[model samples]
Target: MTSQTFGVQDLTLTSVSGSNVDSMTQLHDSYDLAGLTLPNRVVMAPMTRVRSNPEGLATASTATYYAQRASAGLIVSEGVHPHVEGQSNPLTPGLATDEQAASWVQVTDAVHNHGGRIFAQLMHGGRVGHPDNTGGLQPVGPSAVAAPGRGFTPKGPQDFPTPRALSGDEVVEHAASYGEAAARGIGAGFDGVELHGANGYLIAQFLSSNANLRTDSYGGSIENRVRFAVEATAGAVEKVGGHRVGIRLSPDSGIWGVEETESRELYLALLEQLSPLGLAYVHLEATTDDDTLLALRKAWDGTLIMNPARPGGPTPAGPEDARRWLDNGADLISFGRAFIANPDLVERLRDGLPLAEADPATFYAGGDRGYIDYPTYRA
Candidate 1:
């Protein structure tokens, strides 16, 4: 393995060794995503790889990694912070600066060269971050609450800090940041942008009743709680055009001390507001039941990208899972960890080839060992 240090993080590259099976024609079926036609319906889900430099810029390795997995119907890049304070972990990429956006050009160009449509997932960590990770800037959220778990900082894992509550004006400003980042991503040659409103991030923090104890117009009622998400999505849509914007939401996920007691009402109201936006798609990390998923599908008339992961399972979605979600009205299916270890995931799944298990140890260790060294299937 070869290693290099970028800023305060060390990245390593190592090789990894997979077999052949029959083609899954259904999974290989093409689908129309906005104006872009995806060659297949297997999407590479946005995952946090932490492979960027200290200044929060994507490196050449980052470009190569995504380019290797360009076989997917669509690729959603890792969670990219829209601002410095929005970064939740060390070494994660960002779109907050011109240099950052320029750095991402390599990634977009690489993926595009391989005939892959890529979307930049704009993520704001909010209360999920620590000052240690954000260069001494305190994380900001809908309320002054700290996430339950520790955050991975440059020094080491540290306890989550109580974030400052953003004022109504500041909240609007933060929402606008998504739009700015979306434009930056587009400028960098990305096909589109996906707003990260899921997984207990800033938008999720505002949506969750437990995390958001605010009494302002951005909280309290379901409508109020969903205001930030709606505004953020709207802003992104306005900036990049609705056809180039998407939003990802994880309802009923209790991660990071976020408890959405009113998940149903909150998401429904949010969807109602977003349905008319004519956005590209809505990616759902489905933590709810079949009924709720069905309801969500009906509520949002546009395209739905569903990622069905078990409560605590380590495995990513397989062909069976894809079939199930597609039958249930999902326009596309996304695989996370599976893509981490299987660059040829689309071919592997399509041909029923055995998947290479991802090395859990190297997931966020900042390296190419488990990032890009996974080989394609051979007979």
Candidate 2:
């Protein structure tokens, strides 16, 4: 009998091999999550690749790309629009129509075949999108506000238009759409779904004081402002089991003019509401200090996945950072750009191998040049 090999390159000796294992204490440990026993605590965070077809369908290349990085304990796919109005950019994938859902079966099958658990991240861009990018349809948000700055469209960069405020009835309908999308994701072979309620997107827009200025039941007061996110999460949980659902939130992140004047209170209140839902996990983007993060961990009584890096930070999360967070309280640590270049990230971290640097130039320009061309470590 022979052991099967599973990386882009054959295993080889690296400078950090053998000696670095002791430093990765909790990072190398296994944990049971929502009935699934993950091999490790490393998670591949969701990232927009903009590599799908114009029809918002996943291509063969998408399956190949995800299969290459199946070594991660779990893989959260790039932000995928649950509906046409939720699409934020050109060439991003969606789970709206049957064709789009069917296209993802290949990608999911590829990951499962490689012993990987994957979750589809459902993102609604809201005002962050432009008509030029969403097939001439006007973007809609909780309020009629335009996000600050320009957005990249198919033609080029364009100013974001002021989105139409959804009526109370329409808000309910939009929230229900997330449930439909979650059903579609499960049907398409995804293990679960993660609602993108962060990074100044639709859910975050509703939670922001600057972006949401409405006086309706979905805005104004803290409870009202958090109503939309709560409803969206409930809708997703209703369709898919709570154990197969998760939500991502970036508290206090002021991107796209989404200023949370009362972030600490806002998130704590939101978590109090969501803690009883029995959701799979809560993924938080670490934009604040460690004390703040630990405070958040103490508040939420569920599995927490923390991305331990500020947006546009100089350094990416390494094994040391992972161990620190895991030791502190985080059940899982997600890596974004590190997984982009190192498809075999799990093995590299386990054996203490040097990681290849990713090219920033081709991060989102499409094609496979920077998508899947990076080689694994070798002798």
Candidate 3:
């Protein structure tokens, strides 16, 4: 049966505000995203595991971690640094060097072997990085402003430093670097790459009116502020074709002190440029209001993945939450913290099994205890 025939069902969404779409999506259905046919509408949301070694390479444990959760329709790997300066947190993985890219072969191979698809999330920390975490190398951003928060370090959380402002030429190069990372990710056996343009990182920093205090062509105006993010995505599209690229965005999420006064206008302009690229999909977090999000959904023509739960909300995104979003025009639903302890999350959700609770202590302590020891459901 087609999506139009949700006939005689109690589950129905009459319409969403600010958008013309009067349709609803089902969770267990398949979707044609760009060219790849996803088996289900459940995407494994990317979370920062920080399980890599000091050399910025993924471990065999990392391979096992993702392989166990391969039942999801699509897996978006944790934030991966495209370059040294972009490394957001300590002990995170990278796709910067040839060696680093090679290190992920096991991860991609394992996921593919388990009949799963995976994408690498290219993230740049910008002013959020501490020199202590990046081997004394100062971070860089669109402006010299420092984010108003602490950054993770070996000693403990330290104050974020003022990043060196990038010149116009460097900004262009940094934007193009997404293409280089996309090539490496593809070569490393990933199905595609997702540009991490949200959660107050480099792209978000550039988009923020405060973080990106530049008078140049890359700042101030809405179009100018979105230039860096657009260039970054376009670069990836140029290198790996539009079908192989996706981007994650959290409009109006003031994480790490990045703020947008006119989020709706800014994102609409950003999406206008991105739509012509024919991206595989656009993953959006529910940072902004329903009206703004629905408006964005209408503006974007391709597949839309929605993380319905608010960031850092007390409760995780649950089945009910998924149903609500699916009914409201989201093509796919993502679960972040819910996927942590429940490796077989897809099966559990499909079969109506209970989920396991995750240990917060061992989340980033860098051990196998909470990372891979979570067992699947039992009768």
Candidate 4:
């Protein structure tokens, strides 16, 4: 089933009018992904809290943290490194171990108990890590180059180390690792899995010309560069079902010195190939939602999910912004910071109520004081 003929069966899309703020109340109010029905369209984007056990497993706090956000129609869990060497921070958890995989079971159970669907986001922060963080294992990427900035190591902030460019065989190994992680995510009872290909991580490193200097099948031309990501995603879908998968892409992102002269070609070809996978959706993060991406949305032929840029830095837009995307043909809008501060974001948006401000200080700290302590509107 190519994206060209990708069927949209009874997809409940809400109507939106410029003058009517309530028009968005029905957008994707009733949509099914792989047999699971969503109550609404708002999705909680994956965020990194860097809070995990020393052995790199999710703790009880993690489960409680996610359960609080179960009100969202869908939840994309925090980034989980698929491989040990792929670990970005010691505090960041992984699904590589039996315990690590088992720990996430509580999280999925919590979400499902509250009628929420959650997807574990599999991320591999390639050159964006250091040996100090990975038990002396060398960070790997498409090229043996260092990113242009520092990363938070266990000791403290240090320069981003030059990564070992992955051999063709290693690329396959990592892709397989993604598949294994997806399988583990399924075992943990997640509704689905998402490939974290954005934010200059492993996949982004391969996509960017500045980071990927390889001249082989995984580099040079846009097609070759995107091949790694497509293949990785293919492996993930193969392990877990296609309907149980999603991919996040950050085209033209310069984070960590990632740059692409022909991002349009790279992503277009990537999406064109991925369209047939029957994946849940394509998650895109662009500075300003551009028409080129919107054109890709048409080409994608599946549900298109967008992460809008927040004016005040990482804040999720209000109902008006979500409505704007719906009016422009977006299938779903993902909220980051707003979801963090407001657990009942859907009700707040629906009733036109004021939102609570997120305290930036405790965004990543480990404690229930800020994690699940945000109060809902009493009025």
Candidate 2, residues 69-154, lDDT tens digits: the string is: 88888999999999889899899999988899999999999999989989999999989998887789999998888999998798
Whole-model lDDT for model 2 versus the true structure? 0.86
Q: What shift in Å separates residue 49 of candidate 3 from its native position after superposition? A: 0.8
Task: Write down the lDDT of every candidate, Cα atoms only.
Answer: 0.86, 0.86, 0.87, 0.80
Candidate 2: segments with Cα more than 4 A from true spot: 1-25
**Stronger candidate by TM-score (3 vs 4):** 3
* Model 1 C-alpha lDDT per residue in residues 1-379, reported as the tens digit of each score: 2211121011121211010112122567899898899999999999898889999999989999999999899999999999878998888999998899999999999999998989999999999998888778999999988899788988888999899999989999999999999999999999999999998999999999988999989888998999899999999998989999999998988878899977888899999999889999999987887788788998999999999785347656666667666666688999888888778888777656667777778988987777888777663
Error of 1 at 221 (Å): 0.1
Q: Highest TM-score among the candidates is held by which one?
A: 3
Best of the candidates, lDDT? 3
Looking at candidate 3, the ten consecutive residues that score lowest on lDDT are 1-10
- Give RMSD to native, each candidate: 8.0, 5.6, 4.6, 6.6
Q: How should the candidates be ordered by lDDT, best one leading?
A: 3, 2, 1, 4
Q: Record all residue pairs in model 1 with backbone atoms less than 3 Å apart, i.e. clashing.
A: 22-351, 24-350
TM-score of each model, paired residue for residue: 0.92, 0.93, 0.94, 0.91
Positional deviation of 164 in candidate 4, in angstroms?
A: 0.9
